[model samples]
Target: MIDWLDFVVLSLLALGVIFTVIRFVLGPKLSDRVVALDTFNMIIIGLIVFLALVFDSKLYLDIAIVYAVLAFLETIVFARYLEGKNNDNS
Candidate 1:
Protein backbone atom coordinates (compact mmCIF):
# COMPACT_ATOMS: atom_id res chain seq x y z
CA MET A 1 0.00 0.00 0.00
CA ILE A 2 1.41 3.31 -1.10
CA ASP A 3 1.31 6.09 1.46
CA TRP A 4 0.89 9.85 1.08
CA LEU A 5 4.55 10.44 1.81
CA ASP A 6 5.56 8.10 -0.92
CA PHE A 7 3.29 9.87 -3.35
CA VAL A 8 4.71 13.24 -2.38
CA VAL A 9 8.29 12.12 -2.71
CA LEU A 10 7.69 10.48 -6.04
CA SER A 11 5.89 13.52 -7.33
CA LEU A 12 8.75 15.79 -6.32
CA LEU A 13 11.30 13.51 -7.88
CA ALA A 14 9.31 13.34 -11.07
CA LEU A 15 9.13 17.10 -11.19
CA GLY A 16 12.86 17.34 -10.67
CA VAL A 17 13.49 14.95 -13.53
CA ILE A 18 11.18 16.93 -15.77
CA PHE A 19 13.04 20.13 -14.98
CA THR A 20 16.37 18.51 -15.64
CA VAL A 21 15.16 17.23 -18.97
CA ILE A 22 14.01 20.69 -19.87
CA ARG A 23 17.41 22.11 -18.94
CA PHE A 24 19.14 19.48 -20.99
CA VAL A 25 17.02 20.31 -23.99
CA LEU A 26 17.36 24.05 -23.75
CA GLY A 27 20.90 24.41 -22.48
CA PRO A 28 22.98 26.93 -24.42
CA LYS A 29 26.24 25.04 -23.99
CA LEU A 30 27.28 21.43 -24.27
CA SER A 31 28.74 21.51 -20.78
CA ASP A 32 25.40 22.65 -19.40
CA ARG A 33 23.69 19.76 -21.10
CA VAL A 34 26.25 17.33 -19.79
CA VAL A 35 25.73 18.64 -16.26
CA ALA A 36 21.99 18.22 -16.67
CA LEU A 37 22.49 14.68 -17.88
CA ASP A 38 24.66 13.90 -14.88
CA THR A 39 22.06 15.39 -12.57
CA PHE A 40 19.39 13.29 -14.27
CA ASN A 41 21.38 10.15 -13.63
CA MET A 42 21.75 11.04 -9.98
CA ILE A 43 18.05 11.68 -9.73
CA ILE A 44 17.34 8.26 -11.25
CA ILE A 45 19.58 6.65 -8.69
CA GLY A 46 17.71 8.47 -5.98
CA LEU A 47 14.42 7.18 -7.37
CA ILE A 48 15.74 3.64 -7.45
CA VAL A 49 16.84 3.87 -3.83
CA PHE A 50 13.52 5.41 -2.88
CA LEU A 51 11.71 2.53 -4.50
CA ALA A 52 13.90 0.07 -2.66
CA LEU A 53 12.98 1.72 0.60
CA VAL A 54 9.29 1.86 -0.17
CA PHE A 55 9.16 -1.79 -1.22
CA ASP A 56 11.57 -3.13 1.39
CA SER A 57 13.69 -4.76 -1.31
CA LYS A 58 17.44 -5.10 -1.32
CA LEU A 59 17.58 -5.61 -5.08
CA TYR A 60 16.67 -2.04 -5.88
CA LEU A 61 19.39 -0.74 -3.62
CA ASP A 62 21.92 -3.00 -5.29
CA ILE A 63 20.76 -1.82 -8.65
CA ALA A 64 21.07 1.78 -7.54
CA ILE A 65 24.65 1.25 -6.46
CA VAL A 66 25.59 -0.28 -9.77
CA TYR A 67 23.79 2.46 -11.63
CA ALA A 68 25.52 5.14 -9.60
CA VAL A 69 28.94 3.70 -10.44
CA LEU A 70 28.15 3.58 -14.12
CA ALA A 71 26.74 7.06 -14.10
CA PHE A 72 29.85 8.41 -12.42
CA LEU A 73 32.11 6.77 -14.95
CA GLU A 74 29.99 8.06 -17.81
CA THR A 75 30.08 11.58 -16.47
CA ILE A 76 33.84 11.45 -16.13
CA VAL A 77 34.16 10.34 -19.72
CA PHE A 78 31.86 13.13 -20.85
CA ALA A 79 33.83 15.69 -18.91
CA ARG A 80 37.09 14.51 -20.39
CA TYR A 81 35.70 14.62 -23.85
CA LEU A 82 34.39 18.12 -23.31
CA GLU A 83 37.71 19.22 -21.95
CA GLY A 84 39.54 17.87 -24.97
CA LYS A 85 37.09 19.51 -27.28
CA ASN A 86 37.47 22.85 -25.59
CA ASN A 87 41.23 22.61 -25.66
CA ASP A 88 41.21 21.74 -29.33
CA ASN A 89 38.97 24.70 -30.13
CA SER A 90 41.22 27.09 -28.23
Candidate 2:
Protein backbone atom coordinates (compact mmCIF):
# COMPACT_ATOMS: atom_id res chain seq x y z
CA MET A 1 0.00 0.00 0.00
CA ILE A 2 1.01 3.61 -0.44
CA ASP A 3 1.10 4.07 3.33
CA TRP A 4 3.71 1.36 3.57
CA LEU A 5 5.81 3.14 1.00
CA ASP A 6 5.70 6.28 3.09
CA PHE A 7 7.03 4.32 6.07
CA VAL A 8 9.89 3.05 3.92
CA VAL A 9 10.66 6.57 2.78
CA LEU A 10 10.73 7.74 6.38
CA SER A 11 13.15 4.98 7.30
CA LEU A 12 15.42 5.93 4.42
CA LEU A 13 15.40 9.52 5.59
CA ALA A 14 16.39 8.36 9.05
CA LEU A 15 19.35 6.59 7.51
CA GLY A 16 20.26 9.79 5.73
CA VAL A 17 20.19 11.57 9.09
CA ILE A 18 22.63 9.05 10.48
CA PHE A 19 24.94 9.50 7.54
CA THR A 20 24.83 13.24 7.95
CA VAL A 21 25.70 12.86 11.62
CA ILE A 22 28.71 10.79 10.68
CA ARG A 23 29.81 13.37 8.17
CA PHE A 24 29.46 16.09 10.75
CA VAL A 25 31.63 14.13 13.09
CA LEU A 26 34.36 13.31 10.54
CA GLY A 27 34.39 16.07 7.97
CA PRO A 28 37.89 17.50 7.41
CA LYS A 29 36.76 21.03 6.66
CA LEU A 30 34.28 23.36 8.37
CA SER A 31 32.50 23.90 5.08
CA ASP A 32 32.08 20.15 4.66
CA ARG A 33 30.43 19.91 8.05
CA VAL A 34 28.22 22.87 7.35
CA VAL A 35 27.08 21.32 4.09
CA ALA A 36 26.17 18.13 5.90
CA LEU A 37 24.23 20.08 8.51
CA ASP A 38 22.31 21.87 5.79
CA THR A 39 21.48 18.55 4.21
CA PHE A 40 20.24 17.22 7.54
CA ASN A 41 17.95 20.20 8.01
CA MET A 42 16.47 19.79 4.53
CA ILE A 43 15.91 16.11 5.14
CA ILE A 44 14.14 16.79 8.42
CA ILE A 45 11.83 19.23 6.71
CA GLY A 46 11.06 16.71 4.00
CA LEU A 47 10.32 14.01 6.56
CA ILE A 48 7.96 16.31 8.38
CA VAL A 49 6.09 17.06 5.19
CA PHE A 50 5.81 13.38 4.35
CA LEU A 51 4.51 12.58 7.81
CA ALA A 52 1.92 15.36 7.47
CA LEU A 53 0.77 13.85 4.20
CA VAL A 54 0.51 10.36 5.66
CA PHE A 55 -1.32 11.50 8.80
CA ASP A 56 -3.57 13.95 6.99
CA SER A 57 -2.65 16.69 9.44
CA LYS A 58 -2.50 20.19 8.04
CA LEU A 59 -0.69 21.44 11.14
CA TYR A 60 2.44 19.44 10.36
CA LEU A 61 2.72 21.18 7.01
CA ASP A 62 2.81 24.54 8.71
CA ILE A 63 5.51 23.36 11.08
CA ALA A 64 7.51 22.06 8.15
CA ILE A 65 7.30 25.44 6.45
CA VAL A 66 8.54 27.23 9.53
CA TYR A 67 11.33 24.76 10.00
CA ALA A 68 12.43 25.12 6.42
CA VAL A 69 12.58 28.88 6.69
CA LEU A 70 14.60 28.72 9.90
CA ALA A 71 16.97 26.17 8.45
CA PHE A 72 17.48 28.30 5.35
CA LEU A 73 18.28 31.29 7.51
CA GLU A 74 20.76 29.28 9.52
CA THR A 75 22.46 28.11 6.35
CA ILE A 76 22.68 31.69 5.09
CA VAL A 77 24.23 32.82 8.36
CA PHE A 78 26.84 30.09 8.24
CA ALA A 79 27.61 30.90 4.61
CA ARG A 80 28.13 34.51 5.51
CA TYR A 81 30.51 33.57 8.25
CA LEU A 82 32.47 31.34 5.89
CA GLU A 83 32.67 34.13 3.35
CA GLY A 84 34.00 36.47 5.99
CA LYS A 85 36.66 33.97 6.94
CA ASN A 86 37.66 33.57 3.32
CA ASN A 87 37.93 37.30 2.89
CA ASP A 88 40.10 37.55 5.98
CA ASN A 89 42.39 34.78 4.69
CA SER A 90 42.68 36.55 1.35
Error of 1 at 49 (Å): 0.5
Which window of 10 residues has the lowest lDDT sum in candidate 2?
1-10
User: Judged by TM-score, which candidate is best?
Assistant: 1
lDDT of 1 by residue, 27-89 (tens): 999999999999999999999998998989999988999999999999999999999988998
Candidate 1 overall Cα lDDT vs. reference? Answer: 0.96
- Report the CA-based lDDT of candidate 2 relative to the real structure: 0.93
Worst 10 residues of 1 by lDDT: 1-10
Query: What are the clashing pairs of model 1?
Result: none
The runs of at least 3 residues in candidate 2 whose Cα sits more than 4 Å from the true structure, single-residue gaps closed, are: 1-4
Whole-model Cα lDDT of every candidate shown, in order: 0.96, 0.93
